[model samples]
Every structure is written in C-alpha cells, then in structure tokens.
Target: MQTESNGKRKRPKKKGSRFMRNAKGFAKQGIFGRGTHIDDDQFSYFINILDAMKAGFEDVEDRVNMANNVFEQTVDKEIHLSSNQIVSKAIESLIGFVDDAQLERFFGKFGDNLRPMCSDRFASHVLQKMLEIAFLRGLGQAAAQEQSEADAPGPAKRAKPDAAQVEEQYNLETDFSDKHREQCRNFVLRISKFMLNNLEDFVWDSCATHIMRSAILCLVGIHVPKIAFEKGGAELAKHRKLYTVPEEWHEVMKEFPQRLELWPQFVDFPYQEHSSALLGVICLSLSVVDKSMLKHFGKKILTQSLLKPNEDNGDDDDEKKESKIEIDDDNDDQGNNEKQDDNEKTEKPNSEPAVLLPKVFHYQCAVILLETLLSVAGAKLLTQLYAMLFSGRVAHLSQQQQTNFAVQRLLQHIKEVSDFESVFTELQPQTEQLLKMGYTGVVSALSGACLRLGAKQAQMIAALQSALHVTGDKEKSKLFFNCLVKLKPHELLAGDQSGFVHLHGSLIAQHILQFNKPIFLVNCILELPAEQLSQIFNTPNGSHIVDAFLQSKYIGEKSRERLIRQLDGFYVDLAITRHGSRVLDQCFKAAQEAQKLHIAKELSNKANMLKGSPFGRLIYTKYRLDTYKLSASQWQASLGQQQQKEESVGQTNKRPAKTATELFKDILTQ
Candidate 1:
C-alpha cells in the first residue's frame, strides 16, 4: 500500500511540474528581482512564455495568473523592481493576445500598474510602451471596422447607434479605443490626469519627483500639438508643430480642453519650492492652449493683485486719523482720555498680517504671465501689458527692486521676441523717475537691456548720458561710470572734440581711473589730441587719472612713452603740488630708460630746490630710492663710511698748526 501511494504522488507532481517551476522561478528571480541588470537567458525565457500564451498554449490561464501576480507584487513595492524591461516585453506580447472582449479589462489592469510606476525611470518606459501599443491596436481596429462597413451590403443595413449609446460605448472601452486618434487622445489624457493628480506628491517627495517631472514633460510633449490643433484648427498645425497629431479627430478634442483647464492653476501656484519645474509645465501647456485664453485670465488676476493697494496706502489713512485725533484733543476737556483713545486706534494688534506673499513673487508671476502672453497672444498683448506696467496704475504697488526685476524680465522677452527698439523708446520717458528714486540698479538693468536690444551705440550712450546728468550723488556717479565702462562708450568719451571733457570731464577722469579696463581708457587718453590731453593732465582730478594710468599694470610701452612725453615740461611744476606730485612719481616709475634718464637729470639739477619744498622732496626721494635701487638706510650708511674715510685721510696728513690769532694777541699784549 505504501509503494502504491508513493507511485501515485510522484505521477501527480510530475504532470505539470516543469512549466510550473519555470513560471515560479521567473516571477521570483527575473520579475521581482532587486537589480535591473537582467541576463539574456532569463529575459528570453519570459518572452518565450508570453509568446506561447499568445499562440494559445494549453497553460495560457496559468501564465496569465502568473503575470497578474508579478504585476501586483511589483506595484506593492514603494521602489521599482528590476523587471521593467521584462514586464514591458511581457505586456507587449500579451497585447497581441488581447481581443476586443478583453481589451478594456487588460488596459484597466495595465493602467493600474502604470500609475504607481510613472515616477520610476525604467518603469515609465514600460508605461510609454503600453500607450504606443494601445494606440496602434486602436488604429488597426478602427480601420478594419471602417473597411467592413464599406464592403457590407446596403439592402439590410443595420440601424446606427444613437449618440447616447455611442457615448456609453466610448466610456466602456475608454481605457482602450476603437477610434484611431481618439484612442491616442484617451491614452494621453489618462496619463495627464494621473500626472496632475499626483503632481503635488511628486513635487514634495524626494524619491522620484525628477523622473515624474520628466515623464510629465514627455507626455505633454506628445499631446500638446493635438491640443493646439483642437483650438487652432488645421491652419495652426502647419507652422512648426513639435508633435504629430491627427487632424481628423473631433470627439477627443471635446473633452481634452476641459481636462487641460487645470493648467493655469499649476502656472499660478503660489509656492516657489519647485518653481522651475512648474514653469516648464506652464510653458508646455501654453504651447497647446490658446494664448488668448491664458492672457485673458492672467490680465484679470494681475490687475487685481498688482494694482491692489499696499500697506503704504494704509499708513496714509492712519496719518489722516491721527490729525483728526489731534483736533479732537485740542477741542475736548478730557485730553488724557482722548489721547488714550488715539493711542489705541493707532496701535494695531500683534497678529501677523493676513497677506504674507512676497512682492518679488507677485512681480515674477507678472513676468511669467507676460511671457506666456507674448508667446501665445502675439506682440499686441505684450505691448498692452508693457503699457500697463509703466502706466502708473500699478506702479505704486511694486517696490523699486520689484519694478526693476520685472522690467528686466520683460525686456529680456522683448529682446528675444519683438522689436526692442520700440519697447526701449517707450521706456526712455521713465528714466527720470528711475533716477529720482536713486534706483541705480534699475539704471544698470536698463543699460544692460538696451545693450541686448541691439540698440544703436549712439542711443545707448545717450541713455547713459541722460542718467549721468541727473545724478550728482557720488555713489550714483560711480554706478553710471560703471555702466559707461561696461558699455564701452568709448566714442562718447574719446577724441579731441568730445564734449565729455567740457561737460563732466573731472568726473569722467575720476571714473576712468577707477574703471576695470583702465588700459582701454588710458589708450583713449593717449590718442586724445594734445590740447585735451594737456587739459586733462593739468586738472587735479585729471592728474589722478594720469597717476592711475601710469601706475596700472595694463599700461603698455607705447602708452607709457606717450604719457612720459606729455609730461616732459610739466614734471617740475607737477612735482611742486600735492596731487601732481603723485602723478609725477608714478610717471617716474613708468617712464622708459631714456625717459627715466631725462627725468633723473632734470631732478638732479633741481635737487636743492626740490629739498626745500615738501611735495618736491617726496618726488626727489622716491626717484632716488627707485631709480638708484637703494634704500634710505643703505645710502646713509655709505655716506657715514665716506665721511669716516675722509676723516682718517685728513688725520693721516695732519700737522701741528700755529694759530695766527694767538700770535697777534701776544703782539698786542707786548
């Protein structure tokens, strides 16, 4: 009986043991494995099983059950399994096996698995494959049905389904499709919805947000042209379409617009935590949606927020109330009581302000919205927006810095997309207000913006000159000089006939000395006509410029030679004054060998005169130390040694000398 029972058990276990063991091993080692590096043998084994199932093998049900188990296990894990390629291959093969009757069920399961895996890089690849396959299958089926209807006899035509029934059927197989392009639309919309719903999750979660954002961008990239087409029609499709979308489909277009309406919310999300990623989504959406729609919405919101009164306005009201209280105090007998009431009215509670949004954020939103408008609504809307920004309607709402930032961003867009000359010309009138506010930053930004606008060099120089003429503040003067130097307005400052010397010559000279490219300015000075160069060197501030140029490492041999020649006759006179002495000393160091010899000869002749003057003595001593390459102590030591040697020689030759005075006195006394 024991042998009989053993034989029976062995036969039962051996019946389907080979297939079952292979399936189990694939599910464990290949499908739910830890690493992504799958060997070819394991991958082939899984593909072969899928192919067998498609070929209607007897154990098809068993393989299907195993696939379901594999998908479930993969989805339950928070992190991705190494089975993306293996699972994608399995699904690709399985898609061929699925018929119309089971299409919806298959896709329902597929989408469920895809939702959790969208954030995974490799898993997202599998999801993309699912979408492409579904699209192709739907297209093939639609073509077949159309051909069948065309070939069928017309005598006994079947009644067409009503719109309600058609809608129901669409809903039933929404995950899959019978219409070619509608199916593609459904696939993209499904993924978009999934991405939108989980957008906050992906943004906040550090684990997989990068892959999620990439996937979102990819999905939007594929579907944007379709959305653009639905709104823009066929004419809009011909111009630089990034994606290929079908022109025939109108049914999916009906639902797609409503689905994408959530885009503006993402665009206007107040949190700046993941702003760059969010801006990408906004830009992508704007590519498809009608720019007029976003513009209309943006203008309304921007007007409300940007034109809203700020705390400064509230301060004005408080001041009015305080003045009224002072009048009451003067008229009433209860002065102390009235004062207490006034104090209570003026002192606000320590509660936090209701609105905490940063002014910069509001400005950034305005800029991004304006850019979106420009890209979508054309240049007309951009002009209107620009006018609004500078029209003084919302000007008080923005801080100076905020206004500067907004202007920079707006100008950047204009420079890229439109004729910047018109925009810059419009902004020219505001230069006075920008300067009056001491907003040198805005001035610099404007200068930079004008440069980018490809404005004429003369126009840019004129703008900078206007900015300089209005500001007497030392700090603003420095800022304007920096702007001029950066713009390299050499034509405006150089040449013998240039009015810079007559207008702001000392200021220009001082700035040129402090300029980053002192060599460029020095060369400009060297090329100046003899009269202008003389005038520059003669002024106190201009002498400083010459001093700075002579001391600069950037000064070349030719420039030094020219400068030394210019200073030939002025050296003695310059060395006698305080500021000029500094210039003369620097020139002494910078002068060439021939020039140095000339200067040294001149100074030696006037050594006694130089020693008597304070500023002259500084030039003489510096020349001696630098030209002779001797320190003061070394020269003094040498003098002492010479004196000692002379004394020794005198003593060696010494003899007892008779005093003539003593002999004369002795004669007088006798």
Candidate 2:
C-alpha cells in the first residue's frame, strides 16, 4: 500500500455468478457448476450483488442463460400440467400453503436469501414457486383473520344494541358472509367479485376436490346463515360439500310445509338478497315440483316472504301498486272486452312476508322458475303453483311485455340451447302446462318464437296442424289464424316463396270453409274479401282461398255441397266489388243462356196453341201455318227484336244472367 499498489486489483468471481468470463466458456462446453464459486472475491461479490439487486446486465451471459431456462421451464410445465387432475392437485397444494401457518412462514423467510445462492435460472424458478405459495397462503390467512375479527367481542359495548346494530349483526351472521360482506351487503356484488377474480382462472386451472369444494362451499356458505343453521354452519359448510344431497334435505323433505315457514327468514338474508330470493322462489317452486314438498310452513313462508311489506328506501311496492292499478283500470275500460278480464284480481295481503325484492327482477325470475317447474315438476304440483301465481289474478304487466317475454324465452331456449327442444314436443311437460296457462295469445307466442328460432316451414305447419286437430277452443283457433295473417311474409316469414305462413293460411282458410263457420268465413272474406282474394290469385303463383279450397283434400263432398249452398248469401256482397261483380255476371249469364237454348225448341209448340183459343185462334192457326212460310229475313228481324226487349228488361232489373257451369261450381262449394 505504501508503494502505491503497482499491480491492478484482481476482482474475484462470486459463487454461482453467471457473468464470470469462464461462465460463457462453461456454458459453451455444457459444464454445469453446482455450489461452485470462482476464487476471485471481487468478481464474485459483484455478481452476487447484481443478482441480489434483481437488476439485469447486458454483459451478463450466465444471467441470460438463467432467464432462458426459466422461460422454457414455465412454458413446459404449463403444457404438461394442463389436465384437471393436475390443476386440482396444484390448487389443493396452493390452498394447503395458505391454510398451513408453518409452511407460509418457511416460504416467506427463505425465499429472498435462496435466490442468489443458486444459479440465476434455477433461482428464478424457485422464487416464482415460492411467491405462488405465499399468495395462496396469504389469501386463506386473510379469510381466517376476517372470520376471527367477526367473532371478536367489542370493548365496553352496550349490553343491548340499537335496532340498527342488531340488524347489522343479524345481517353479518346470515347474509354478509362473502369476503367483502362488510363493504357491500349485496350478493350480486360478491358474486361479481368472485366471478371476476377467480372464475376464469379456476375454470381452466388444475384444482383438487377439496379446493373445488372449498370454492363452491364459499358460494353455498353465503346462503346457509340466512338459512338459520347453527352458528358454525358456515364454517362447517366450508368443509362440507354438495357431493350428495344433504341429510337435512331428506329429513325436511317430508316436512316441507314446516321448512317453508322458517325458510323465509333465512331466504332473504342480508348477504344473499337477490340470489337467495331467487332460491327461495325455487324452494317454494319445489311444491310445484313435488306437491309433497308443499308443507303448511312452506306455503306460509312463501306467502309471507314473497308478499312482505317493503319499508326499505329503494322499495318498488308503490310503483308496482300504481302499475297494477293502471293495468287493471285499462283492462276494465277497453272495448275489446277480452276473455281474460273477467278473472278475479288477487291481492297479496299486507300481513304477507315482505318481498324485499325489486319487482321487475322478481317477475323475470318468477317466469323462469315457473317455466322450469312446468318442465320438470309433477302435474298436480304444477297445477297448484300455477293457481297460486296466477291467483294474484292481477295480470299487472302489459300485453306486449308478456308476449315479448314469452317469445324471447322460447327463442332463447330453442336457438341457444339444445336441451330446450323438449319444450317443443307434445310429450314434454311444458306443453301441457302451456295449455293450462290459457294465455289469450298463446298461439301468437308459439308462432313468433318459431319464426325467430328459424323453425322449418314443414315443421311449423305440422305443429299448427297438430294443435288445430287436438284443440277444442274456438277462440284459440281464431287467434292462431289471426296471428298467421299478421305475420305472413313479414317480420319473421322470410324466403322468396316457401314459408310456413303461406301454407298455414291456406290450410286455415280451407278449415273455415269446411267447418261451415259462416261468421269466420265471412270475416275472412271481409278482411281479405273476395276482391282481395282475386288480387292474390293475380299475383304469380299466388293461389287464393278459392284455389286452396278447390285443391283441399280435407274438404269432403258433403262439406263442399254445404259451402256451395251458402255461397248465395255471399253473392250480394260479392257483386259490389269488380271481381265479385264479374264472377256473378258470368255465372248468371251462363245459366240463363243454357236455359234459353234448351227451352227454345219447346216454346214453338206452346205458341201454336195461343192462336186457337178464341176468334183469333183461327187467325193464329193461319199465322202458325204461315210461320213456316215466313221469309228468313222477317224471322231473323223478329228474333232480334225479342232478344233486344229481353236484354233491356234484364238491365232494368240489375240482374246478370247465370251460367250452368257457375251454378255447378256453387253447388260443389255448398
């Protein structure tokens, strides 16, 4: 030192250092260094410090190799462990890391120091694993901590809390069990969080049975408190899973009425407001599924909870009341005087349990649950539930809303899911239930749904044909016919020519004629009267009701004879329009012309007798004798004068001559 250190200071390479000059040489030679260090302390110190600092260096060849190895391993493991079993195992291990206190500490403490002690690449791989373990453990710890804090006693708290505090406590215990239960007492909020934070990863990630059960338990556990199980029920449920039906479910299965009574207090717990409310509806709907589930308690509980008085700030009771009133008032006054109006309006009693739900959402949920019950539940139960739901007797929603909802649901089921095909079948439970609902425009709903779902023309026509054959209700049949008229080749009926509506209309028109329902037939004529029918015929390949009738296999000889007899009543109205007038004139002229031709020869013998009756008889005898001698020009002139006289009288009477062929057609239709 005193001689000014003439030689340069040689920096020693750090142990496990990748930046050492020999590192490139070692890597190039494929020589692995395990727990080895260069003899140069200064160089080793610099490399170790760089690694510890987590800073990248361009000149560090060993560090680069380490990074490359880490990237490769991550890609490889990710591909290799992609199965559900692997994901499940990994999730279990991750959960174990969080749940185990000792492992958490071990990973936390050793994670930093171990990094620089090994090769940079190997160190990084270990570090990533350690971090995942830490995070998993931390999440469990946080959940546990929150649970404990919730159970903790307050300092010098009042012996009896205020109503607000009491309510809060009840809410905390029952509904607010989600991770953020304290922050927001909303089930949707919690579900949204869970879905956003966990669902996507868990969907694809490997998870163990316990881990998956734990996740599902977390969701189910949120509902148990409101369900009024033991104090530790949520915790117990966390361990328990829905691998099979609960023993309690079976025990209370026979005592559904009793369960129904207590179920409400638990149903709308503060934590699971909307979902529990939905589940409660589903629970009540079980009665619809299995009538045996309809315990007195269950019915009472449903009545109480669903019909509860709303005192909350955001309650929609008043608006619903107003809307109901408005609908009722409108219904009472309309001139249409629909069949539905005569039904009694059933009001939910004020003593009934508070619905605590938003009405629109409630309506939507009720509709869905009702439809589901119809599909899966027993007939007796369906009858009861349908009676109960519609018993409120207030069809509070607008006609358009109801129709739109039905069509939308039907379309969604048909077009979006294959499982929903059951609804379209006659054998399906929903088909019978749909008939029982007795919706005024139910046929319209079906037709609209079929149109939107892209149902084939033949299939749709067959469905209608079947419905018509089995149906006993005339109004329903009429509604079906009317719907066909409204939507033909518009809104839903697409294609250049081949659609169900075209065929359906023809079939229905033929049915009306065959059935001899003159009013309906007349109504059809009036709506798309004879004039319109002819116009339709004029369109290329557009066969009117007449053509359909002529071609119909359904109409028998007897029915056709009856229809032809009835045509006389329609002739007067038909004559007003151009097509009707033309058809009538042609028919009359043809009949008269044939009659005149047949009778012309017979009239000569009768005319010869007219001259012999009196003194003129002798002169007539001469005229009759002279007629054979009369000139061709004179006979022709006499015939022309007689025809002119007959034509003028026919015009004065405003009647057209009838044709024999036209008369025959009329007879055939009758």
Candidate 3:
C-alpha cells in the first residue's frame, strides 16, 4: 500500500502488495553512529583523507587510499566507522562513489572482520550498504536465482538464494562476469554466516536490528529495494516495504527474541518497540505465500513472543546478556570530528520508570505487531491470544495513546458473536471517554465491529446518539451523519467553501451505511436537505458515502429513487467539481431511465455552468446533455437504445443458467 509519489501519473504498483501476509511495512532507514577515533594513523593517512572526504573532497585515488587506510585501522586498532561520524561518512563515500576493482577490493576486505562491525550503530549501516552493493553489482546472479525459484508456491518458495530479489525485468547479465558475481557472492556468504551466528545479538540490539533485517533480506533472497542502496550511512530513513519472505527466514527466526524474556526490559529500554516492529516486518515479509511457514511463524514466533504466561509466577523468564560492542572510550570528538555531527549518542543509562504500566503503554511498536498478529494468527492461536491479550483489555487499551492502535486492530478482528459481546460489553461504557479523548479510530472500529458481527446494533445506535448528544429530530435526521462525519451543523445547513472532508467522520459514516440493516442510516442520509446532500456529493470521501447509499443492497428501489429525486435540483451542484462530478456520473449509472432523463434535463438547464469545470465538461460529454439541448425526444430515444444494448451485452456475457430438467438429470445421474 506504500506508493511512490506518482504525481498524477499512473504509478507502477509494486506487485508485492498483492500477496497475502502480515509484514505490511518496511524499515524506515539505516541505523547510524559515528566511527570510533583512530590512533592518528590508517592512522595518519586515513585521518587526513577521511577528513578531506567528510569536508567534501572528491578524488578516486584519495578514496582508494581512504578505503585501504580505514580497513587497516579497522583490522589493526579495532577502530570502526560506526563510532566516528567522519569515518562512517567517508567510508560510505568510498563504498558508494568509488567504483571498479578498488570498490570490490574495498568491500572484500570486510568479510572476515564484518562480525564485529555488525554490532555497532553506524557501522551496521556499512554492512547493510555493502550487501545492497553486492546484490546490485551481482544483478545477474540475483536475477537467475529468482527465475529458478519462481515456481515455488509453498514454504520452499521462500528459500530462494540470498539477495535473489531484483526488479523483475532488469537485464543485468553483462554487468559483471559470472566469476566476479560468484566472488562477490562468496563475500556475501561469509558476512551472512557471521550475522547469522550473532542473530541473537542483532535481534535485541536497537542499533543492530536494521542490519539484521537487511541480512534477512539477503539470506531470504528478498530484494533490498534499489532505493535502499541510494541511502548512505548517515541518512537513517525508512525505505520501501519488505514485500515477501522466503522459507529460509524460518531458520533465521528460530531464535526470534522471546516475549517471556522481555517483560522486565519494558521498563528499561522501551525494548518492545524495536522488537515488535521487527516482528511486524518479518510477519509481512513472509507475506503468507508460504502457508506452512505462516503457520509455523504464527505459532512459533508471534504466538510465543506475545502470549502471556500460563502460571501465576510470570517473572521466571531469564534475561539474555546484552551483546553490545564498546565504542572508543575517548569522548573528545575534537578537531574535524565536530563537523561529523554525532547521529547516535553513546549508550548511557536511563533511570527506569517507577511503574512498568506507564512504560508498556508507550509501546507503539507492539501496536503494529499486534495488527500483523491479528491478521495472521491461526484459529487456535487467535483463541489463545483473545483470552490472554485481548479478552478484558479492550476498554483499558482504548484509553492509552499507544495501545489504542492495537485496540483498533483488536476491534477490527472481532468475528465471533461471543467475542463481539465481550468486547462490546467492555467497550460501550467507554464511548463517551473515547469520543472525549478523540479516539475516533477506536470509535470507528467499534461501530464497524458491532455491525459487522451482527451484535448490539441497537446499542451502537444508542451509544452514538448519547455520545453526540442527539436530542432532537433534526439531529437524528439531518445532522446525524454530518456530526458523524464531523461537519459543523452550521456548515451542513449553510456552506462548505473548501471540500476537505474529515476522514474519520467519513469512515464512521461509511461503516454505518455499508453494514447490516442500514435502512435507518439510508433514511438519515436521505433526510438531509438538498444543500447538505449536494455538499456531501461535492467531496471525494463524501461522494463515497452517497455512492454507498445508492449502491447498498439493503436500500430499496423506493429509497434509491427518493435519493435521486432529492438531488434533482443539485445535479449541477454535483457536476462542478472532480469529486462531485463522479457522484453525478454514478447518479446516471445507478438511476432508472426516467431518473437519468430528469438528471440530463437538469444539467441541460445549467449547460454553461455544467461546462465550466473540466470535470463538469467531462460529465456533459458523458451523460449526453448536449443531445438533450439538440432534441429531448432524440436524447430519450438514444438513452433507451443504449440501455437496451447494455442489457443485451450483459446478458450475452453471462454463463447460461442450467434448466430445472438439466439440474434434475445431473442430480439423478450423480
């Protein structure tokens, strides 16, 4: 669902979004910190060149010189780019802009020493960038690896060769010889082994978690998007989504940081944030293409990490030792290092909160993770989670700023009538608090959940009436949906110069009008005076509300006819804007022929104003109002012929229904 800014042009939809899975997100950016200061050597030469490069110097010889010196300092003194900003930037420059054999040699140097670097904040970015470069450079191998694995429809489908994902139609075979590709790949294999060996360390380390995801992409052959390669070490920004995970991820996830062990750290590091977000990425990456893997992931990783303890004594889970790498002890980032603004700070101790409740409430990552879990967990796991995590927590969670997101997800997933009743029982009392708190998403989801599960519809109606203080016939009739969509009562009655619609208000309206037995809701919409109806039809989201009413199966033909007749004088009002014009078109499509004729006559009445907007002009051409201007009788004849042809065409395309005799014969034969 993450789209590039297509800017009014048709955007190429990333095919990855179509997959069925939970990791519907991506890591925003590379983790960063400055490199540790060296002993004025890789020492003397690297210090000078790194400073020069960080100062915007450009020369291949200097970069090659910098790469060699930096690698030497890394090997000899254990100094790293992760701790020093200049060094991280300079190294990023060398790896990125520096090309030819020197670049390969520069990358190849880190294969053995890569394990230590993966533990640092900024240094891990170097690892992520290196992997991106290797795959990009080895595009031939990446493409081939992808082609070979194309037929895998199950768990094995996720086990493609590391870094096999590339833009589908890119032909990069001639970029590098196979021998060179294999060499770069060997280096990648060594790095992968090193990270895989330290998977436990990476999973828990905030700085190293990004490197962990990048490595997962490489290991599972998930394409680290080219835009990721465009990110240098300093820019800690989110990239494109991790579309799908290959099967090998299960092996990688076998040691996913356990929730049983993470409870206490909730008060210390906000550890659950990164861990939960990581799980969300993993859940989405698996993309549910692999049913076996999804089942395994749901059970082994998500269920286990999030589930509560079976026993009363829940504090028994052991904690793992922290595996952080020590940066240079010297705090003097003096000299040119000042220009290297420190992106990551030295890890200092934070005073823990007095209570764990406050700490857990701020866990934003858990919200996303819970959403992924809600979508993918199997029936048994869902029941377990519903009992353990959600059963009584819906009302309490809805009050928090962070956990309310999870509450919304929980509300959206309510299916069973028993579950809906349990949730509704707890949540209905808090509606006033929720409305006061502006937890409209929760309120919106609450309405959807109630109507969707066919539970407590009358109660929902009552709750909304009370929450909005609907004490009058006018409030119930005209302003109910308007207030629900958050339009000011005054604006509904008089004006809306700007077409901006409140999305949450519109969502609440949409859920109401679309769900079971929306006749009363349809009547509320219908009862809106013509000006308000025109205003609703004038905005994009508002138009969807009108379209829903026109298209709702629960709405009778009499109700739909009333809706068309109500908009009788306002066809021009609906025709003047893009959003409104769409409603105008829908009216023509959904209207009976006589209703369509009335609509055409109205547009012809304001022919010049209807022709004013480009969108309105399109409406004019589309509904044949010009034919009405020429001859009303001819326009009616053309409209009749068009409807007849459409009916005939639709009938011709249908699968012929079997006769009763045929059905009887088939049943008897069977």
Candidate 4:
C-alpha cells in the first residue's frame, strides 16, 4: 500500500507497478497507434499540440497558396514564355510533378507515382483528373497568352518577365495544370527502353509503361484540335489559340527536333501495342504543331529514332559486349559461364549505360527546325536559313536524300492545308523552289496541280521537263511523258504559234530521240492528222530521219511490226503519192536488209489493197511510174542476199547470231 502519495492509489505495490507499465505501454502505443483510443490526459495533450501545429501549417499553406496563385497569374501574364516553358509546364503539371502534398494526398496512392495507390478505383479517377486538368490548362494558358499578346504591345515592351521568372511562374502552373504529361511521356519511354534493353525482371506491366502509353494517346489527340481550322471559319482562331508559330518560339522549337526519336525507340519493338499508340500520338503532335516546327524536327527525330546500331569500333571488348543478346541457351556449361559472367557484371557495375539517342535527337531537332523555316516563311527564307544552318554539321546526310525529304514534307504540308492553293499562289517563288527540289513525286504533284489550275502550256511543259531531269524512275518518266502528251495536243498545239511549235517540236523530238527503249511518241505521231504527220515526217531530211528510225533499237522486230501497222493505218487514211513513195522507198530498204518478209509482205499487201482505191490513184498519179520495181522475185533475191551477207559476217567474225531486236540494238548503239 505504498502508492497513496497523491491520494490516487492505495493498491498493492506489485499490482500498481504492473498497471503502470501497462499504462506506459498504452501511452506509447497512442503515439504510434493503429487507430486505438488514448487516455483523457493524452487526448487533451494531443489536441493542444495538434492545434498549434495546425496553425503553423495553415500559415505556411496560406503563404504557399499565395505564391502558387501569384506564380500562375504572372506566368499567364508573361506572353513571351518560351516553348520549353509552356511544354515543360504542361508536361510537368500534367504528371503532377510540381504539386504539394495536397495532390499527393488525393492522388499519390493512385497517381503514376513509384507505387500506385492501394485502390484501383481511386487511381483511375485521379489519373483522369490529372489528364483533364493538364489538357485544359495547357490549352487555356496558350489561349490566354495569345489574347493578352493581342491586347498588349510588342513582347519586349509588354512586360519584363525574364526567362527565369517565366520558367518559375509558369513551370508550376502548367506542371500542376498538365499533371505531368511530359513526365508521363518520358517515363513510358524510359521504361520501354529499359525493358527492351534489359529483359530479366523487367516486366511489361510496369506502371511507368501504362502511364506513358496513356499520355502518348493523349498526344495523338493533340492534332484533332487543329482540324477545326481546315475549313476556314474559326480556322485561324483554332491555329492561333492552339498551335502558334511565334518568332520567339524558334529557340523553344529547337529543343524538340529530336523528340520523335523517343517515340521510335519503343515504336519498333515486337509487342509494342502500347508503345505504338504512343508513337502515333507523337506523329499526331508533329503533324499538328506549327508547320515550321514540324518541318524543322520531323526528319531529325525520325532518323535518329530509326537509325540502327553500328559496329565499327576498334575495341574487341566493346564489340563483344555489344554483341550480347537475350540469352536463350539451356546447356549446363554455357549457363554456368553465362551466370558467372552475369555475376561478375553485377559485381562490377557498368560504367555507363548505352545512349539511345546521342546525336539523333540533335539531328531531328535541326531538321524540324529547318522544316519550320520552310513552312511559315516560304522557301526563299527557308533556303537562306537552311544555308546558314546547313554549313558544317549537316554533312552526315546526303544532299539528295535531304532534298528528297524536304520536298516530301513540303508536299505533305500542301496536302494537309485546305487553303494551300491560295497560299501557293501568294508564294509562287516558294512553289518554284519546291519544284526545283527535283523530287519526282513533289514535281509531279505540283505539275498536276498547275495543269488543273489552267496554267499556261509553256509552264506545264517547263515544269514537266524539270521533273524529268531529276528523276531516274521509268514509271515516273512515263507518267510525265503521258501527261505531256495529254496536255500538248489540246493545250499547246496552237498556242502563241512560235512557242507552241518550238515547244512541242523540241519535246516531241527529244522524246523520240531520248527514249531508245520504245518510241511511244511515234504512236502519238501516227494518231495525228495526215497533214500533221506529213509536216512531221516529210521534212527536208525525211530520208535521213527514216534512216535514223531504221537504226533505232525502238524500231526492232517488235516495234517494227507495230510501226508497220501504224504505217499501214496511216497509208489507209492517206491518198498515197510520190512523197509517200519516197517514204516507202526508205522503209523498203530497211525491211529488205533485215529480211523482214512479214513486214515486206504487209507492205506489198497494203500496196495491193490500195491498187484500185483512192490511195492507188494518188500513188500512181504522183509517181507517174510505168511499172512497180518491187517484185516477188526481187524481194526473194534481196532476202537471199541478206542471208548470204549474214553468213559471211558470221564466218569472218565467228560471232554469235542475234535476234532481229538484238541486231537492231547493236546497230542503233553503234
């Protein structure tokens, strides 16, 4: 009974001691309790301390709240914020990169944090909110800045929001707003890259993987907003609010040229359903963003991301290390060796991880930047800027490939824009440069457009000629030729007479001479009226021209029969005469020499067919010949002579006999 000092207890000493220890333990548990009750005194003390702490926390929260508000407001006011600022803010906030414990309290468990929340239902809601807020905020801020800029004077004079201040203010605002969209993009990419690079324990179901994929899909929808402007009303408004090409943003755009490479790292993987969706988003973003920016970065990002690994290092160790792949072997000996190696490697950490991008990002960024210069300002300006940037570093790419890509991208833009026609008209010089790009598709599309626009025949011809010179593809050449043929007779035949005649004359002759494969022009020529044919085939040097045709590989066995048919068709239409006789004389010699009896027979049959017809009368009257010198006997004798001459040549040279077509090719080239 020794515990009666405070008149609280008169119990036994052992009982009191045991109870006190229990009480002490219970009090400690209250400090670290799992939802258990505390005694009255403990409760009172806790309430007092909690009140004081809450007051202090409230003051800090109030100040932080004020700072956050001011930062957001100032960032909204600063119209001159760089694209990095805008993008960084949008991405950082979208992923909730900058939020305080408040956001964490609500979403930390469920958000794309290191470990997601315990409850799935809560996570989905939190993620959805983060995406919505980020998207809305990014769009809103962009719109608000544009509106403010419209109301204000020049940016420099508008406000003194330096880079740091702009970054600090908008960084958190957009970060909070976007909820860490960029981080999502980055994380998904990082996870995918890592998983692909390191297979073991790198499960596909990583949370970072899902977040990145979702974020990428969100990006894919980025361009959908721009589609509203495709048809005029609120067109500029849409572009203005959502996708702008502010001169000040040039530097910001520079950073993103290689952004596409990040996409390809995951895009090419075997089971990259998630990664592919993300890549699609990236492509959509590239398509929707400022055209100039797209032009600048599209290729750079595309190339860097798509480039394969090269192995030319002199070090065998590096080469051997690079050669390593996912181990599939099960042999005991190999497994032992592999495990040992792995353990050793684990013991000795790699000095550095392989860089996925290296110069790829820089290249893509440069290209996209160059593309932007070409898009907004026009080719002249872009070319000038291109010249400036392309001096030293661009030596990696071939000139031809670069030009091809540039023209291709330009055409893509032309296809993309609804008002491309109007824009093209306003920028003729630029169009001309695009044509000068010498890409087959680019030139062809432009030429077709010109034809559709009712551009002058001279222009069309010039454009086609330009296309033909640059391209080596036979299909494209044929297309250009056919297009010219279609346009010439209708649009060009009777033009300002000199230009028309000279143009067609030069082009037709060039085609006849240039294409030794087969003279499609001859078929076209035969289709012309007799008068036109006469004008073309009955020139001062008609005989010489005939000799040229005979020497051509194009007029060999296959084409010769066709030409004979064409000639027959032409003769049937014509009232044959002395001039026709002269032409026939030239063709007769080649047929006789080649021993083309079929062609000879056809010629004679045609002659006989015309013997009593209108052509017969014209022929007889014009020739005034008493008799026909070509006879069956003479034709047979000429054939014999050609056979003898061929035998003699074979005996003298011991050369292999050739087909009629082969002989024609030999003679024409010789």
Q: Quick one: best TM-score, which candidate?
A: 3
Off by over 4 Å in 2: 1-265, 269-290, 294-301, 309-363, 373-395, 398-670
Off by over 4 Å in 3: 1-193, 204-207, 217-272, 285-362, 471-478, 487-501, 604-607, 621-670
Off by over 4 Å in 1: 1-112, 117-190, 196-280, 292-377, 393-403, 414-460, 466-483, 487-670
Please count the clashing residue pairs in each candidate, in the order shown.
0, 49, 25, 35
Q: Estimate, for each residue in 1-670, the C-alpha lDDT of model 2 and write its tens digit.
A: 0110221122333332333445435544543233223234423333343343234333334433443333332332332221212121222222221213333333333333432312232232332333322222222222321222223345423545432233223222332233432222122223223322443232223221112222222322212111111122224323211112223323323332243245434434212323333333334334322444534324443354433443453436566554544564475445234223323222433322222222222454444433433333333433343334433332221122332243333322333322223333422222222322333233334444444444432344445534333235553443444333322312222232332223334434444433322244434343443343444333322334454444345445454333333344343333334334333333333333333222222223344443434422333342232442355345445645766888998678552554333332222111
User: What is the lDDT of every predicted structure here?
Assistant: 0.45, 0.33, 0.57, 0.36
TM-score of candidate 1 to 2 decimals:
0.33
Assess every candidate by TM-score. 0.33, 0.26, 0.61, 0.23
> Once superposed on the true structure, which residue ranges of model 4 sit more than 4 Å away at CA?
1-109, 112-129, 135-407, 410-670
Give the alpha carbon lDDT tens digit for every residue of 170-265 in model 4: 432443424443443333333324323432222244433434433333332221221100221133223222222223223332232244344434
Residue pairs in candidate 1 whose N, alpha carbon or C atoms collide under 3 angstroms: none
Q: Is candidate 2 or candidate 4 better by TM-score?
A: 2
Top model by lDDT, which number? 3
Residue 628: error of model 1 in Å? Answer: 46
Location of the lowest summed lDDT over 10 successive residues in candidate 4: 223-232
Q: Regarding TM-score, does 1 or 2 come out ahead?
A: 1
**Cα misplacement distance, residue 595 of candidate 1 (Å):** 32
lDDT of 1 at 312: 38
